[model samples]
Target chain A: GAGVSQSPSNKVTEKGKDVELRCDPISGHTALYWYRQSLGQGLEFLIYFQGNSAPDKSGLPSDRFSAERTGGSVSTLTIQRTQQEDSAVYLCASSRRQGEQPQHFGDGTRLSIL
Target chain B: AQTVTQSQPEMSVQEAETVTLSCTYDTSENNYYLFWYKQPPSRQMILVIRQEAYKQQNATENRFSVNFQKAAKSFSLKISDSQLGDTAMYFCAFMKHAHNDYKLSFGAGTTVTVRA
Candidate 1:
């Protein structure tokens, strides 16, 4: 992909339902990250995957939020039993490596929990 | 943990003029990286400029530039010859230089609107 790609650009579901967002990082990018942007707020880091290493899950807000990257490329973020507060934009970014490399981002998926 | 702050919530600029957005961060780490990102209504995060803590000189990219002060913990972005396309939300971000620390801490963002 020329840039990071996210699917289902918009999602609307009822509370208590589970939702999954997908991300396809730029080709050859070894580092992938997921973030959440609430209404009128800055992006909050959720998870980071660097190559084959165990993902850095320190930023996950709660147990309901989980993410996994398969084959070190495509990543999926799943929210279990979504709450009204879960309504926000889920963003995905990828960098050539990690460290000082600037991450490229996708347009993001806007999740609305009604 | 690092924290970035953008005191201004909104700003207005005239096209062809220049505008500056303020940002400050709190960090104890000496080695780190700072960045300015622009997100328009389209919601794509675009990197405008980046400054390394180790570099005393600021970073500039065409019409976008940053005034990075290490001691003051401030990284302000300046847009020269602003264009209508520059009307967007600007974010300030900080990242640690450590190999294991790749996540970025971002500010609340400042919304900039350009007037014709």
Candidate 2:
């Protein structure tokens, strides 16, 4: 793809339900990232995936938050037992090889936990 | 730990006028990168400009330019001839010089409204 692509642009789920957000990074991009942006807040680092190596999950806020990237292309962010506070926009970005290249971001998914 | 800060929560600029958004960051590492991202109401984050810490000269791309002060730990963005399309939330970001890694630390965004 020419740019990063995200799925489910808007999702409204009930509290305690599980939600999944998907991201398709640019072709040949090795580094994938997941970020959360709350209402009127900064982009919070969530997780980073660098190739087939072990993903850096240090930024996951809680056990309910988990993510996985397959074939180093598409990534999925899953939130189990979602709470109302989880209502926010989930963003995904990918860089060519990381380090120096600027990241390209997707349109993001607006999750509304009602 | 790297932290980016944008002091101004909101700013307004008339069309064709210039507006400067302030940003300050804290990083222990000497070699790093700074960036400015614009997120419009459409929910897409667009890269506005980027600067390398080692470079002394500023970076400019069309109507956007950055005032980078490495010694003072400051990186501010100056938007010349603001337009209505420029109305959006601007975020300042920081990333360190890690081999094949681009993890960014972002600041709370500033909402800029370009009035026509």
lDDT of each: 0.94, 0.92
Q: DockQ of candidates 1 onward, in order?
A: 0.91, 0.78
TM-score of chain B of each: 0.98, 0.97
Cα lDDT tens digits, model 2, B41-107, are: 9888899999999999999999999999999999999999999999999999999887745688999
Off by over 4 Å in 1: none
Off by over 4 Å in 2: none
Best by TM-score: 1
**Candidate 1: residue A63 lDDT (0-100):** 99
**Across residues B13-52, which tens digit of lDDT does each residue of candidate 1 receive?**
9999999999999999999999999999989899888999
Taking all chains together, the TM-score of candidate 1 against the true structure is 0.99
Using all chains and alpha carbons, the TM-scores for the candidates as numbered come to 0.99, 0.97
What's the iRMSD of model 1?
0.6
